[model samples]
Target: MTTAAPDLAAETRDALDADVAALRRGATLWTRLSLDQRATLLESIHASTSAVMAEWADVAATSKGLPPGHPLRGEEWLTGPYMTLVSTEWLARTLRTLAGGGNPLDGVRMDETAAGRLRAHVFPGDLSDRLIVSGFTGEVWFDRDVTMARARAAAGLGQRTPDRSGGIGLVLGAGNITSIPVADVLYELFASNRVSLLKVNPTQDTLVPVFERALAPLIEMGLLRIVTGGGDVGAYLTRHDEIDHVHITGSAQTFDAIVWGVGEDGAARKASGRPLLTTPITAELGGVSPIIVVPGDWSEADLAFQAEHVATMRLQNSGHNCVAGQILILSEDWPQREAFMDHVRRAVAATPSREVWYPRAAKRLDALRDAHPEASWSDDGRRAVIPFDGGAADNLEVVEQFAPVLGVTALPGLGQDFLDTAIAYADERLTGTLGANILIDPVAQTRLGDGFERALERLRYGTIAVNAWTAVGFLTPALPWGAYPGGTLDDAPSGIGVVHNALLLDRIDRAVVRGPFRPFPRSLTALRPASRGAFSLLPKPPWFTTARTGASVSAGLTRYRAGGGLLRLIPTMLNAFRA
Candidate 1:
C-alpha cells in the first residue's frame, strides 16, 4: 500500500502567502479592540463554547473509540470548550481590571523568595475557589532579575498599550489537549498582542469548525484564523514571510524539525546557524517529568490515598500528558515503601483499560517495552510499569514515554538528605525543565521547614507542584506555564516563552502549586464523615478511569456552563460515585 505524496504545488504556497499577508494586515485592526470590546468578545466566546463542545466532543469521542455521550466525553469538554470558556471568563476579568485604574492582584498574597524572585500567590482568588479546591493553592514566581515594583507594573502590558503595528503569529497546535491550541491563541491575541493564525493538528483537524464557532468574535474581528492541512502546510507557514513569530505544542523532535530541517540536513543547518525557518519560536515541548515522594512514616490509609493520587496522574489522558509523571522517584529507606508500591499496583490494576487514543502512542509504548523487557505487566493488562532498581543515570531517567507506561526508581536517604538527593536526581536526569511534582507529609514539611521551601525553590522545573500533579499549575489561568525562562533559541530544552498568563507578567520564571496531601472525595484518612461530604460540590473528575459515574457529567458541565446552577450540580454529584 503506497501512500500518496503531499501536495506541494506553487499555487498552494502562493495561496498561503496571500493569506499570511492578509492576516498581517488584519493584525493592525485586531489591537484596535478596546479592553471593554475585547471583554465583550470573550464573553460571547464563553457563551458559544457551550454549543461548540457538543459537536467537538462527538468527533473527539468517536476518534478515541468512545460513545459520544459517554463519561469519557468529560475529557474533551473539560480540556476543550470548558477550558476555553474558563479562559475567556478570566481574560475578560483581567481586561476589565486593566480597563479601570485597578490592578488584578488586589487581594492576592505576595512574598519575596530568598533567591530574589517575587512570588505571587495567585490561587484561592475567591470564596468559591477556596471551598471547591480546599487546601489547594498556587503561586507564580517572576524572574530573579525582575523587581517587585516592576513585576506589578508590568502586568497587562498588551491592554495598557495596544500594538498598532502588530504582526500575524502562527500557532502549531497540539493534537492531544483540545484547550492547548485555544490557550495559545488567547496568549497571542491578548497577552502577546498579535493576530493569531492557529494551525490545527491533522489528527484533530475535524474540530476546526467547532473552534471557528467558539472563537467567532475573534474571527469576525479579524483577530484570528484557523487553517487545516498536514506537515506541508505547517512547513509552509513556518517559513512564510509574514509570520513574525510562532508557538508550537508538541515533541522536542518536532520542534527541531521545524526550526532546522529534517535528517542530516537539519543537523548541518543547526550547526551552521542557517536554518530554513527564521521566525522567532516559543514552544511547549514534552519532557521526562519526575514525581518525588519524600520518605515518611505513613498509616495504611496514607499509602492508599497517595497511591491513587500518583496513579491518577499517570492514567490521565492515558499517560499522553507531556507533564504527566513519567519517572516516579521514591525513598528506598522509607518504612512504607513496599506498602506504597503495593497500593500503587492495586490502584493501577483497579483502573479500567483505556484505548490508546493519542497518535503514535502505541509505537512509543512498543519502543519502551522493547527497551525494557523487564516491565511488569500487571493485571487488567491495561498498564505497564518498568521498575528501575538501577542508578539515577539511565535511559529511563531521561526519555519521556507518551504512553501508559511509567518508570519507578527509588533511592536511599531520609528527610532533607532524601529530598536533596531526589531533587538533584530529577534536576540532572530529567530530560527537560518543564514541570515536576513533590509529595511530602505535612509533618515532614514542617521538620524540613525552611530547608523544604529552599529545596522547592532550588528545583529547576518551569512548574513545581507540592502534593499535587503539575497540571494544576497549568490549569490555573493566571499562572504562566512553560519551561523555566532562561533557555536560548539555539538550544531550548523544553522550548521557550509562557502562556495562560491572564495577568500578563513580563518576566515570568516558573509557577508553583500546592495541594493538600489528602483532599475531599479521596479522603483516605479523613476521620470525620462530614469532611468527605464536600465532594458534593462537583462530580469526581470524569477523566479518571475509576470514575464510573453513570450520568453524563460532560452534559451536566455543558449545561452548567450555559447556566444550570445547583439544579444540574445535584444530579452530577449523585451520579459520580456509581463507579
Candidate 2:
C-alpha cells in the first residue's frame, strides 16, 4: 500500500508538470498572436460561456444548497454565470479596441478627487449599462502619481508595445464562489497576457466540467488549463518551476502557507522575512469588511430600504463572500440609531434561512458566539447579531468571521465627527483592507460635502462602496479588486495586487462604486430633485437574498447579457418588477 501511494504521488506530479509545461508553451504562442486574434479568441470564449450558463448556474446553486426552487437560488445565477458572461463581453469589447489600434479608455471620463487622485469612470459604458443597472456608477481611482497621460499610456494589454512576451500564470481559486476562478483565469489571459493554469478549490470542483465547457476556446488553444485538487496540489503548483507568476483568491493563512512553510517553520520563516517560495504573487485575501453609518434625517422609507440594504450586504451568499459586511459601525449620538438596529433585525428575520455550506462555518460562528455571550441569534442558529459598545469588542473587530455573523458597535459623536472616528476605527481595528461600505443620507452627504469625500479618502480600503455593497466592485469587471497597496511579503494584511481589471490600468489605488440610496420607484423620490439622472429602473437587485423573483430575474438577465438582445430584457424586466 505504501508503494502504491508513492506511485500515485509520482503520477500526480507528472500530470501537473505536463500541464505547466503546456502552459509555458502556450504562453509563447499567446504572445505571438496579434491583438485581433486575441480579441477573436475572447469572442469565442463569450459564446462558449453563454452555452453553459444554465447548467453552470444550476450546479453551483445545488452545491451551495440553493436548489432550483430555493429563494436564494438567484444568487447562483447572478454571482456565477451572469457575472462571468457580462465580464467576458466587456473584456471582448476592450480587446477589440486594442485590436483596432484604438486606446481602450480613449473616451472614458477621467476626473480628480478632492485630494488630487485621478479617477476613471468605468461603468455605464453605454446605454445598455445605464439601462441595466440604472443609477449605479463605478470608478477606478488611480494612485496619486498616476496622471492622465501616464494612465492613458499604461492602459490596455500591449497598448504601449504592440507585441509582448508572456509567461505561465498559476491561479489559486477560492472555494466560496464559482465565478472567482473563471474571472481570475480570464484576467490572467486577457489582462496580463499570460497563459493560465487554474487550480480550482476542491469544495467547488463540481463546476469543473462546466468551466471546461465555457472556456473551451482557450483550453483548445492551450492558453488555459483547469485542474481540481486539495492543498497538496496547490502547494506543488505554487512552487513549480514552469509557473512564472501566481494569483490567489483565498485567506491570509493560505497565502502564508504558500509563501512561508507551515507551523513552526512557517512562523520562523515569517519572523526572519525569509520566504520559502520566490515566485511573484498577487492575491485577493478575505477581510473583516466594515459598514459605517453616518447620522442622517432619514424618512421611514429610507430607513426600511437601507435596513434591507444592510441585510443584503451581510447575508448575501449566506455571508460566504470575502467582501461581506462583518462589522456595523453606527454613531452613538445618531437619533435613528436604535430605530435602524430594529429595522435591521426585522429585515434579517424576513429573509429566508440559508444553509451554512462553507467548511468550518459552524465552528467559526461558535467562536464568535462564545466571545460575545450577549449576542442574539436566529431560531435556526444560522444567523447572529452581536452588539458591543465603544471599541471594547476587540474580538469582533479583529476577526474576519466568514459567516452570517454581524458585530454591531457604536462610537461617540454625530455627522462629520462620527464619520471621522468611525473611519479611524475601521482602518486601525479591522483585520483586512479589502473593502468597506458607508451608508449616509444623500441630503446629509450634501451637507457634509467635502467632509464626506475626505472621510472616503481617510478610509484605508481597496474598494469603498457608498450606499452599496462592496461586492458591486467585485461583480464589475472594470474595477480593480484587491487590497490597498504597500503590503510586503512579511507583513501582508490582505495580500497584494488586483485582478478583474478589464481596462488593465496600472497603479490603481482603489475603486469606488456608488448605487442609488433607494430602490427603483423609491429611488426617484429618494434622491434630490435636482439630480434626476441618478435614478435607476433597477428594483431590488436580483442578487438580494430576500428578492422573491431572484431566480427568474437573474436567469433572464443572464440570457439578455449572453446575446439574447433587448427583447430578452422584456421578460427580465417583468420578473424584476415582480421582485
Best by lDDT: 2
Q: lDDT by residue for model 1 over 192-215, one digit each (tens)? A: 778888899987787887888888
User: How does each model score on TM-score?
Assistant: 0.92, 0.96
User: Per-residue lDDT of 478-539 in model 2, one digit per residue for the tens?
Assistant: 88889988777776688798888888888899999998877888777655664522576877
Root-mean-square deviation (CA) per prediction? 4.0, 2.5
Predicted structure 2, TM vs. truth: 0.96
Residue 70 in candidate 2, Cα distance off native in Å: 0.5
Q: Tell me the deviation in Å of residue 398 in model 1.
A: 1.9
lDDT of each: 0.76, 0.84
Looking at model 2, the pairs that clash are none
RMSD of 1: 4.0
Candidate 2, run of 10 with poorest lDDT: 1-10
